[model samples]
Target: MQPSHRYTRLTAIALGIAGVISFGSAGATGFQIRENSVKNQGRAFAGSATGQDDASVVSNNPAAMVNLDTTTIRTDVTLIDLTAKFKGGGRSGAGTPLTGGNGGDPGDATPVPAMSIVVPLHGAFEKLTLGAQLSAPFGLKTEYDSTWVGRYNAIESEVKTIDLTLSAAVKITDRFSVGAGFVYERAEATLTNAVDFGSGICANPQTRPLCLTPNPTAAAFGPQKNDGLAKVKGDDTGIGWILGFQWKPTDALSIGYSHRSEIDHDLAGNITFTKPGNVAAVFAAGGVTTYNNGPGGAALTTPSTDTVSVTYAFNDQFRMMFDAQQTDWHSLQSVDIKRANGNLITSEKFEWDDTMMYALGAEYDFSDSFTLRGGVAKDESPTNDTHRTPRLPDNDRMLYSVGLTWNANEHLSVDAAYTRITIDSPDVDVVSSSSSTLVGKFKGHADLFGIAAQYKF
Candidate 1:
């Protein structure tokens, strides 16, 4: 027999009852990834607003490109390893028997890559220069076992984003320069979590608080739970801008400042949720045989960033660089997803505060062909204890890094760097969809290794 109209409507409502949230911690605040450029990673990104070594400066301070006279192309890749382990006394606030072990280590390895090109102009353009950069500016992938104690809170989250920048700089005088750029970015996300069938119908906005009473259909799946998967993926192109200024007060000191604007996106996609066969049968009998929904809706605004840096060359062999950056994470207060019907799917309250990051780096030139680099940095987390979730157990971090550069030839150079990051333990106390709560502590550490090659044309 064909599915009834009531059953079809129910299914569609179920599908539209949820939306999406995909985020992970990378640096500064939220899941903003900053490891795309290796040469910058070597110095913990310390003089990034000014420069490190190659055309990649276009990603940070385009004005710095005026100092580079060569037509160059550079590419870099980083292998990042993250280890996050949760350990603590876990209890269910729902006052029910727990399911499985505290989520095991939820961290994994991922690779980030980037490329940029810079060309100096002469004659008509004289002191003006042009450059472009392509890189992953935000990303995250964290997964947990399906049966983990906090599975209902989160099972997995994967997010990917890319930023492309077209930039130009003009040297107004021998001592000063200014630059600006237009940026285009795209982002996609996928997330999953278990369903608490035991608690009643999921608390979707369209339904009454007690929509799923102790009915025959609701009783079919009792006590235990139903496995649910939520997949919401979409792509949107957003526009932003970047501005930078560079100053050379004297020959030995250089100062640079840069600002990157925020981009907002109203992502359009499809949201699908699947349940076990037994639960499906119950839903089918209750006029929810199949799920249906129009385009799903998710929205987010990547934060704006500002950086100031100073580089001092005490002598020809040694140099020091220090940098400070501020991220306006407050712009991202919460993530509330809705379906086409304007019903809520899910909501995340971050109420995040602004963040500040500082870095100090030093470089020593052993010879014209060889150099050594080292740096230390501190990064603050935007999430507070009360709002921290298992999916993003982020905390303040300390970083140490070392690297070296070899000028293989006048036209070629290679750079390699390694960094160790440590974070203070953070407590994870998140409530699940079924109204149960999972509480614990999470500890984490990360390692970053990168290599880059630069060719001067």
Candidate 2:
């Protein structure tokens, strides 16, 4: 059986929503979040897999939990301030100059929080440890002026997630330990953009004849004129697994390795459009489907990651650490959206490349109660110039960090950390099917401040 015209129209409208649903930004790279632990962030996460300094290890390397002798709890929060601005010009589908100011600073400050608890077993299970953690492993947010020259490309884009992890670790011997974890993550996204109803109608072969005639509707709407609004919202939950091992070959050195599996989600939601009065009249007069609202969904995959870290203690008062990590961003070759009946609506191309991040750090015991920390890192971006867009103008970046740890008492400690990320300016040239060619350069940076407290019982 053939689909109805209304069904077909809904499919077409949903395609536009899917097109912009692929938007994202990154605090780490490609929308991954890395501010789960203030103590780790202080060292640019260099020794995360082997640091084992607090309960945060439950999420970084569960195997390291074998080193915790008592029950411990840790909580942390980080305030991230991001700045991304665009300087450029654009043209409409009709090859006419698009007019509007460069969108104002589209970046905003956001807070990320996390918590973890670890408990050591007693008696026959003395070598066993169990843990739980709550964190945001991936997220992003960006908003542009509604009337900006690139409005047709994107206006607002946001993605948020919450992850809960249950983990276990067992000491096989004095020198080796292994661990594993199960994760349940929930994700949601909301994106918006302007739609050129005039150009879209005139560009459609089925409707072009109507547009060419002496119709008041055609006269009132043309190219960049009579714009409508499109919005898409979706949410889903997924599961993944984590495996890791920590090895101590000598009293002064610790080495760790960890791997996280990928997660897949089929986000379900609705797409809605708001048309102007003139456009509504035109659609009504021509007996065209209004393309108002309908069900839609998209399939997304959170990439996997692998990391290796080493921490060396030269003396009781100081130590140095190093980490190398890689993300399998190739899993994101494309994003495909579908209708409620399972028919494909559209697919957006990404072709992202896998990337790696490296960091080095050191800690110095300044006194019996105070420790100082410093670090640096190089974070690679997954997207290149050809695939970059206004919704996500991410680029390679350098990170510099410093922090302090205070042991207030035998059972309590506090950590404070700060970091600056400098991003390289990259040019963007996005050509739209609607004839809107957005050409420009982007400047971006971020500052992060974090604090955490840990207690042992």
Per-model clash counts, in order, read 4, 1
Local accuracy of candidate 1 as per-residue lDDT tens digits, 106-146: 77778888999999998988889999999888777788887
What overall lDDT goes with each candidate model?
Answer: 0.74, 0.81
Q: Write the per-residue lDDT of candidate 2 for residues 95-134, one digit (tens) a residue.
A: 6788788888887888899999999999999999999999
Summed over model 2, clashes come to 1
How well does candidate 2 match the true structure in TM-score terms? 0.93
Top TM-score hit: 2
Tell me model 1's lDDT, rounded to 2 decimals.
0.74
TM-score of each: 0.89, 0.93
